[model samples]
Target chain A: MMVMTQENLTSKERFDKIFEVEFLPQIDALYTFAYHLTYNEDDANDLVQETYLKAYRFIEKYIEGTNAKAWLFKILKNAFINQYRKKSKAPTKVDYEEIINFHDEENDTNYSTHTDLREEMFQSMMGDEVTNAINALPVDFRVVILLCDIEGFTYEEISKIIDVPIGTVRSRLHRARNMLKGQLKTYAESLGFKDKRSKD
Target chain B: DYQELVRKVTMYLDNELSEAEAYLKVLSQEKSFREFIKSKLHRRKPSPALIKSIKDKIKT
Candidate 1:
């Protein structure tokens, strides 16, 4: 594994400095994204480790002072997708339009099955209910919401990270957020959030 | 029709052409949904031990 040594970031101390200064600050956010993708603490930690490992191994290729968070996220997402493909028993491509059509035909209000979300749930809703909802989405939809809504990446940036056209990103985000709207509405209605929210 | 028309107008004015329909549809759904998603799921702080573990992995 021969790595190119660029001029400025060539020295050992300089390389360490680049890793610490650029990548370390993004560890928390990277961990959150990893956890959401894997939904397991150990697996999430492993994914983050792999991301940094790859980042360091190819640091010479990384341009200085660019969007490092997005770069790291792109690596993490690619790793997760590769593993997800291995684990999934379904067909290789989890086509977004197909999934959307399937659910729309079933009139499925719920996407992910973590539906223990009740009205009292909203009273303490600052926590797992949101995660449950996000975790339930199919990976295509989930990544769009995660990258766009959660991570605050622009559609163009997310398109590049996720390696899809911007049009695909737009449609996926629309569908994903719409699916969440239905799922969260069920929880909100049960938790009296709708009524309480309206009065406020 | 009229409300959607108003919404399309607003969206067009904002140059969010792609989101006009989705935005209008979402309005009929939940008003505070975006805020809820953004605020609650902003970013969870990783455990202190995990932070140390990452630093160890990267440093050593």
Candidate 2:
């Protein structure tokens, strides 16, 4: 819990109120979302710190009694898209099949007991395959999938968040799910599941 | 025809399609479509560490 310095605050009373009310409960969740997007602990911390600083600077613009989580995510997502994604091209163009195949090959020798292997497979997943699959999708589909499936946002909320029609949200979600199913099918086959058919 | 069927079955699985539409789809569709949707609905959860990492990032 980092405290806001009085010198950094414009007014002592106002800073006290903001610190007491807005800053405490929301910081953890905000940081977690940032971390997930950045995929780096240090970067996530910096993003959260930056987000709070920006939010604090423009606190007057934020409407009270509205959904704070949505607002925060919007800011974070925008920051990620505009600032981070643009600056870094390293993570943007990953080849999913190659990565998965490489990883599978490297870990092949470690397979021992059935129970241990299952547990290891589960532990190794780390959502990398799913994230890679989603990232490989078109931007519209990726955004809709992340908001709806990964973040558990509703269609109406996503409509507001992405500034798209509800119908568009539904259509994109459908496409995204289909794409994910296709990717998962490949992953399953690689893992020796035998079945390569779409389940949905 | 297969693509159209797939799209309809997808909507039905998501419960987005109307009852009448779903009824038509399910009745006319191949058995494999239903099996597909059933398996898809049972998606595995992402690893706990991944969830925790995301949660931790948001918290920071």
Give me the TM-scores of chain B across the candidates.
0.38, 0.40
Candidate 1: deviation at residue A183, Å?
Answer: 2.1
Give the per-residue lDDT digits (tens) of candidate 2, residues A150-180.
4566777878877778888887876776676
Residue lDDT tens for model 1, A1-200:
86756663356567688788988899888988988777677788888888888898888788878988989999999999888888786666787998888777566556334234544564554356777788889999998888766677777888889999977877777678667866787776666556232311
- Write down the lDDT that model 2 would get: 0.59
Query: For residues B7-51, could you state the per-residue lDDT of candidate 1 as single tens digits?
Result: 344334323577534544444334456667777665666778876
Residue-level lDDT of model 2, residues B1-60, one tens digit each, is 246666666555545567646445343433343343334332332334544543454345
Backbone clashes counted, model 2: 17
Considering the two chains of model 2, state its CAPRI-style docking category: incorrect
Point out the worst 10-residue segment of candidate 2 chain B by lDDT: B37-46
The 10 consecutive residues of candidate 2 chain A with the worst lDDT sum are A191-200
